[model samples]
Target chain A: MSPGGEALSRILYVEDDHDVRKVATFALKAVGGFVVEPCESGQQALEKAAGFAPQLLLLDVMMPGMDGPTTLERLRALPAIAGVPAIFMTAKVQPQEVSRYRALGTLDVISKPFDPMTLSATVRAIWAGRDD
Target chain B: MTELMGAEAEMRDALRRLRADGVQRLGERVRELSAGWAALQPRRPWDDADRARLGELAASAHRLAGAGGTFGFPALSKAAAPLELLLLGLRDTPAPGGDRLRQAGAQVAAVAAAWEAGPAGAEEDGADPGQASPAEHGEPIFLFAEAEEQAMLSAVIANLGYSVRRASEREVLEGALPEGPLSAAVIDDAVPDPLAVCARLAGRCPLILLAEDSSFENRLAAARAGVEALVAKPLEVNELADWLDHFAGGRAETRYTIVIVDDDRLLAAAYAMALRQAGMQVTSVSDPAQAIEVIAATAPDLILMDLQMPGIDGIELARVIRQTRRHLSLPILFLSAEQDTERQILARRLGGDDFIPKPVDLDRLVTLVRLRAERARALRAVMESDSLTGLLNHARFKERLGLELERARRHGTTLSLVIFDLDHFKSVNDTHGHLVGDRVIRGLARSLQKRLRRTDVIGRYGGEEFAALMIGTGPEEARGIIDHLRERFAAASFETEGGSFGVTFSAGIAGNAPGGAGPEGGAEAEAMISAADAALYAAKRAGRNRVMVAPA
Candidate 1:
């Protein structure tokens, strides 16, 4: 297998439980060979402004404590991140809500229970299509 | 190499164990502190001595806060926040300067002590959060850094039923010095430069600064900065709380002084007591000869004058007052045991606002005094208001017009003037009674008031004539509004004792003219009014009940 250097370019992964930080950790490091940071709260991801800081920031918008909009405000405060794209991974993403999230400063939001097999490749394609 | 690696791994494991143990201990300490703090409640019946003892108690609590969090007892440190703030405040403002501080300390201490006594204290002092009103607890706090310190302070104060917040560094001085309803602020003088902080905070809030040592210069500077006082550090929290309580409490009700110009000593004293009970400041003067001196000095809101006194009768005194010109509008209530209606009417004609019969009903007398005082304030407002048409009077109008003209000229806009007069108003007063004439004038004023926009001002210019200022309105719109008013006045009817009769008025509208327009069109607003007046006179001459438009 090709050194997996190209596979490390983008990542899309989801886990509802915070206790399993190691599961996403192994997938990012060994399988996808992607740089990854694990977070317990959607609030932390927004605070970090991963969208502007890196090539991608996969979000679980319906996390406990601070919900999506609040995280969005914190992310928006970062001036460098203007229109740096975002995507929400939710278990219940209706087509209407997907458009709503897209309207709310997101490029695309994927439905949850996404196949781990194709996750990294799918995320890479999405990133490649981004104008920014 | 393998042996060295094993040693490094063992050292790392040891460090992890220490961190874990430290976190657990911190969590336990926080729980204990929270439990201890939740027990605090304010207690009553605290004397001055109890308030003074609060300083020592606060010092101990301050030490606890400084040590508890550092020792991994975050909860205990957190619990000490309000106590630390209170203690620091008390320590900085000891003795006579913070008498209220002592009372507040006594209350906090009593509650804290009661809480320490366990379940019984909790049952007795348990705060019904629902019962606690925002008024007592809405003491705003300025946020500062030191998350644990702020949290502890907020918790302790919150338990005491005060709303608390972390003050920003920039706002710390302002937070310490409250402008409006704040009782007091516990200010730390150790921040970078203490004197500068004191000066900034003192500008707004009454600052009770934490003094490290007794320096006379520091005290003098604090006083100059409007700081209430400085209490040396190693604080007594209770005494500071007491000081906050007193100053933060409602101010005493306002008292009015009534100087009685009656000569009977017993009666004067009786009236004085009655007025005092009615919450007024009373000065009794039995000698009418000293009336002017007493009146000028005391300046009571109302004067109760005794008619048929030993030296001067009430009517003559009333006339003297009217003659003073300064006291022309002063309400003089005549106190006459004299039971004659003719005398009462004569007293009123002589400028007595009211007549209190002999054997005055204490209640009626009190009611009359309050009524007169209120009316006096109203009259003062009215003296600045136009008397005839109930708009701003001439003096106020001139000031407003000048200001408006300056603003309009600055912005390069037009200000217009309109002058109105009743056509043959002299005939109305002459043919009909003056009462009927007054009704017609009032009717015209009401009609103008309703037809014009709210921004327009209408003031009676002497008798049967009025003036109006229309801001930002051009000559066309001003004339349109004036014409509408004239038409409305022509259609309106005035009711008199005899019968109702139709009334009419003539108006002239003029706008701000260019500098070289004419003598009548100069930049001076008076020119505009005069130009409008000229057109108004022309309208009257031309015919009755018509609009006369002046050239811009």
Candidate 2:
């Protein structure tokens, strides 16, 4: 259970790479014990986010069409998921880039080349760190 | 727990399958990236059409970088990253330098090499990279111990990521000198004539003595011989590693002054603010044309540049900078939206330090910049310092004098310049040998350093003569400080091999000569120095071993 007073069970995961998505979905579901709905690109995530009613928005930074940051901006405009918390997962992010991401009201950024075994624990820690 | 174990077992099997499936795609991706190697010729005309082709290549590399690390090959991602960055940077350049293009080729070659050697890492693709500590120190540590302890000691040090150069204690006693410029040396207490060996290695490198019993007498003897630390025989490897790090970190740490040249004002301002917060002095120049003036005036420790600018690009500006003899070796790091390859090659040839790919992780940038500046500052200190005594050299002292004077005048504050000459110096050298005379000089230099404020610039002006620039102080205050220094030296005991001896100095101080706020040409700097010289002559005539101040 998160500080939001609900169990963080459903995560709307967006990533363009099929291999990464396949492993991450397994990491979130089988290893992490969470119900995961995966989207292949930013466009698909935007289409599915409204109906999923996810506990969190797990977005990838680089995508083919809309990209991570842009998708977050567009998804935020919708009434259903306007105030939902978001986190960015990327390969590398500089300190300044982290500041920029934070200014867009992100919870935290998990770096890529991340160990799949510890993926869920990282997300749980992020959840625990936030008070509200 | 059993339920979790079942899930974990399934996860590993899934990981193995992911690697088997992704390995084919990894090979194809590297092949695609390598396909455009011929098009990256440095001599070829770089225009809009070439840029389009390079963009396509960069997109491919970018995809590979994001995907490979997640699959079986993290090395594949690491290798493709630099090439992708270089291509992305080069595509934006209107006329990229030849050297930068060559750098891109090298990165591409590296990608090919990484792919060849990548399968070894892929076997355990799901393993965590965070467990490894990056502990590779460049300088080798010197070891002088018993032959029995050599293997165990070297293994422990090597595991901590240091290369150890070992020597037997018997070899040293036989006068077989260890090759050094070594950072630190570890010696054993069991060694014969350990004090003699310690004396030789003391000032050259940090000495850590490994004591068999670790007694009080051993500590005292180690301290007397100038060993930095004495480690007990049953080694606390962690504690030993800490001491090594502490000594190595004690290099001249100066506050680096940096200039950021970019067209983006907001970006430059952000970086400047960040650097300032990190205890650095930073200046940001938005206009490329005005950047040259700023760079010249500041003579900054480092320059952070952008490859693409409006008036003149970073390459042309770097060329202009390299043309100047003084700034030829100044460290310049390129920070741009798309960083690397053609621009990198060109920048390296022009003596640029590194290409920090953007959007840069600020922590890495700060650390790298600090490391580069620390090395530059340390080298500059060696150049500016007097060899015999670590005070500023004669020429550097005078240069500091002018700068301090101008700064004091600008701030509407007082500054004092004092010269100290050892009295009866020729007679002392005649009575004692030249070595004792040199010891006396070093003794005076040490006393001055101990007594004077850190802000005061002290220098060995000549043989047996020293000068100090004391800012924000009046003549009366300056005279009081020097008077204390004079009495301290006259009474203080200086023990040498030739036996105990004492020395005194005559000091002349000049201050507030450039007084009053007259905007246009109030006082000349030459008059102030002349006044100090006259006062010194007066001190010599009246009596030596006293402090005197010139009339304002």
Candidate 3:
């Protein structure tokens, strides 16, 4: 959902694990009340990105075909959604890796084993405070 | 709060449903994959087809390992990890005997069986479903206190989000020490011969002493016992919490990179494994000739080099590294079996920061390496940082810019630079005096530091002007970020003696994206700086408080 007037509505989530995708999608839809289009792989994400017109890209770092950073690079090359903000979901998010992901222009990183109940709230907080 | 509870309930219900669905799907997949694996089982000598089959098994195992954990089947995940590793190894070598293949196949079948049998079977196999062990979480703090004090201290530490173990007796403490690596140890004064106990546990974990004695003798004894901190009782929970916070924040999980160089492979491996167990990223080099290459690639925080090697000695290697301008201040530690005092002195003279003898006590070695590396890092920060703003100084900034440009060229990535000058900074100084002007400058520095990503290196280029190196950012994105920073800075008010006033800045951005003109050397860095400077001037000419991107 759009936090204030920024219209951070459409979120394209790319995760490999079907179970995680299912639970997280339920959280975003029922708890977060946002329109979420979940993709199983980075390639599928790239194929659907322009058509979905998501305001934000929630990507998984380690995917099978075209990992999150490479996918972000390709997405940035496309004229549509070139400047959209992106966030990464990763399991092994060390301090150095977090900085590296940020260098790739991600707005933030959400570590894995995330709380399903609070996941939507966390996303909303990041979106609301992005201007800072 | 009620809405949040409702949402939580909803999420929990959804997760329960998903877990059920996932378990069923996992059982089906495991059965199919295990059947495929059993059919491919080698009866006699392994061949290419068997190797290919092993690859398939490994890939499926990898997927299972990842999915099992996510789907609330941690037992399956745990069983699959070693199997995956085993299969991958077999795929690589394929020469493992029939026994090895049999063991791998049995392990795969066990995992499949575990999945099929569901929760009851996993519990029967002694696998905890959702709970992770303490070691899997993080290193725990060990507290040695009197029986009366133990409960209070442990409760306080546990409340502070630390996994703590309490022991009142020496035997119990000694047994607990081997359970896992400790983050830190705290001892109460009531413990008999506390100094001796502290000395015994000193290098193993950072030790803190809580003593009632404030005498100089006791303080001196505690210092000699290698205690990092001594708190005079009665210890406040808040004070102990503060100390624990510092210890946890500075734990080795920060992943300080270390490079160990020794011609002796076994010795090097031992040192590497010990350091790695302590949470340092360690790379070992057996050949001194490859020392420079490894150092360049890893950018290690410390170098542990053996003094005596066959061809190039540690002294020569250290000298070679010192010859490189970038690594001049990097700490080089000498580890040697030689007992010659003269050689140790020579090694220190030739750029060795510290000397440790061979057959190093593992605990002492880890402590010394951590201390020296942290000290070197602090010294470097002081030397390279600006005094007023704490950003990189001009000279250090330029040096890093050159290095980052070289890296970007080699990696075929983009590097962008943003230069921002405070608009009418002279007028601010003229109106509010230099003291307030300094405050305004510091204010902008703080904002930049807070707003920019950690990977973006911000530096005070000169008086009232700041620059940032945005690695992997393009011209347009850099402009957007800088423009946002500019707008925020314009809106921020600064307090002065007279009243409050707002400050704004103009910025210029230049990026070298991939497939564009590649930056070669220091000259390219200089060109980028000049281009950004030219664009900054344009922004100033077009009325300040705006951002401009340098034309490609």
Candidate 4:
């Protein structure tokens, strides 16, 4: 049932919200054409970093346990997550703020209240932007 | 999920009861007012005797208008709005007809009747029942203070827009500053120790230190604690409001960048050092051309530019900076040796905060820069730049002055305002090339600054004019200081393009004395300037180059 664009190109999705995870999990499986793994917290993501071996990480900025930025900082410390293409999802995506996040090594930010239809395509686009 | 549902149900039930309580309270007040009106014994509903009764009814109507919304009876509240308007109309109408009286009376009565019915029709009325209620269930402000002094202190903090929750009486920290997004938080120097609180909210919120005692040790302690600012006791509420506004606007409150553009390496280094001493994050550029690019990347809080540059002049740099968004509100204070009113006015008009005529008055320049940064952070909503010296922008000064005012109001402290002006700044500019003339002005800033207390505030008010606020000082003492500054400035030997020149300044001093009003609808600090301005003018009229004390 897969388009078979890429296999085992690990995807790590960190979100505190369960409903968002449920919706995203389905979209990634059906449309993303890649392996998808979901984690609830930055700490949890850090713990599963070795085994999951994600090529790309999608992180939610605002969360209860360890925020996205802090999580990214910790991830940068780990050699496995180093140089991994990262994207942030946040409510604040103003030009100046986005630039700051970009300066911190984030390739792009997918704004919150994201489109359920376009989530997979956007991630694919970010992945492409990195190669170029 | 079940637990969450239970919590929602509890909230819904609490809101329902609150509505019922609001309605009952409104009904009781209305009935009590009605009885009072009946006892007044009016001859006719339209007569002058009914004036107090109408007033009482209007008061009840006003109360219901606010109260009704609490219970989700928004329509009842909206219906009561007309009564306020009608009552206003009646107050102006000398002889009102029975129709007006009957309408007002009926409206008030109907509001009371509606509330008495409880929150029955609230849902059907197209109002979000929950929207009409307070965010939290009635939680009376509690402060954990063993002593009355501490309690009073807590009251002051509570009044300043903090939800001070009392933890335990033994707890040194009063209440935990709610762990939510806060614009800014106030940490006292001693009790409710700010170190832990600042650490908790660090990088999340800007922290302001309220200094109970203005001692070197205290200030050092505050600085080590990583506080954004140290606002001494007798703080200004306006200043606090400014800090809050800066944070609320989501501007960087942690560190501010000041761009110094100069052709002279030595001079640039000196100015940068002075700015750093004032605690500003400084970026110094030896060339004027780099001002645009440097400012573009990281928008600085303020800019200090050398008037004379090798390629593009300081004025041109100022114009270019004005064109850039990063420098839009960026105060560009010219570090020039240009002293003409027309030239200074030109720089000011080009969006320059103020021009520090060189050989930069190190102390005054530093103080002015700090004040300007504070003002920029505080009054992001208002105009910037001081009128004289064209330094310490207005919005920035207002924020600092506001903090000073709030502190004064809280701590029962005295703040003095001193206004001083160059006795013949115009003639000097005319006689000497505005270049040499500017050196004299900068030199004067240095002299005057030397005469001030370390805590005193001095800013260039406008052309040949300056204002100083001496905290915890009286008018007499302020007058003495101002008079001394004037004498020293007059005696200074200023070397210019032509030759050495001597200059004199005139000053006026006023205190925020009891029953005192700010002159010209500004503020206490401003009023003091007005009094001082008037005194300065008087001194000029009495013959230039003398100091005049504001009339007691």
> Top model by TM-score, which number?
2
Which residue pairs in candidate 3 collide? none
lDDT string, candidate 4, B1-89, tens digits: 99978865764465445445545665676677566545543655456656766675655555444345444454455445455456656
Tell me, per candidate, how large a share of the native contacts it keeps. Answer: 0.00, 0.29, 0.14, 0.00
Model 4 CA deviation exceeding 4 Å by range: A1-132, B1-390, B515-526
Task: List the lowest-lDDT window of 10 residues for candidate 4 chain B.
Answer: B129-138
Could you give candidate 1's per-residue lDDT for residues A11-125 as a string of tens digits?
Answer: 3332333322333344345445577666666556654554525555566655446665556656666675554556665533334667788788776665433323234444554
Report DockQ per prediction, comma-separated: 0.01, 0.16, 0.09, 0.01
For model 1, residues B1-552, the per-residue Cα lDDT tens digits are 999788657644653354345335434433443443333224223345544445445544433333232223322332343444444454344332232344334334433442343222232221210111223334443323234444654563453334444455555544343222233455556555666666665534456666676589878887886668676654333334334433332222134568898875544554554465345777888889888878877756789988878768888887887786557778888777778999899989998899876555444677899899778857766776666556667666665566566656766777777777888788888888787777666666655665667767667776887777788888788877778767766775654546666767888877775432433222466776677888888888888688777865
Task: State residue B347's C-alpha deviation in candidate 2, in Å.
Answer: 16
Error of 2 at B164 (Å): 35
Task: State chain A's TM-score for model 2.
Answer: 0.94
Who wins the lDDT comparison? 3
lDDT, model 3, position B430: 98
For model 3, residues B1-552, the per-residue Cα lDDT tens digits are 999898778767877798678667778768877887777754446688777777777766665665575565655665665566667766775366443455466567667765865654433322232222223345678888877888888886786667776774664445334333467888887877788888878877788889999589999999999999888876644456557757764443356799999876555655664475456788889988888999998988899988888888889999999999879889998887678889888888989988886555444678899998888888887999998887999999999898888788877889899999998899999999998888787778867876788888999999998999998988899898888888877986766547778889998888864663654667788889988999999999999899999997
Off by over 4 Å in 3: A1-132, B1-255, B264-266, B273-280, B430-436, B495-499, B513-520
Q: Give lDDT for model 4.
A: 0.62
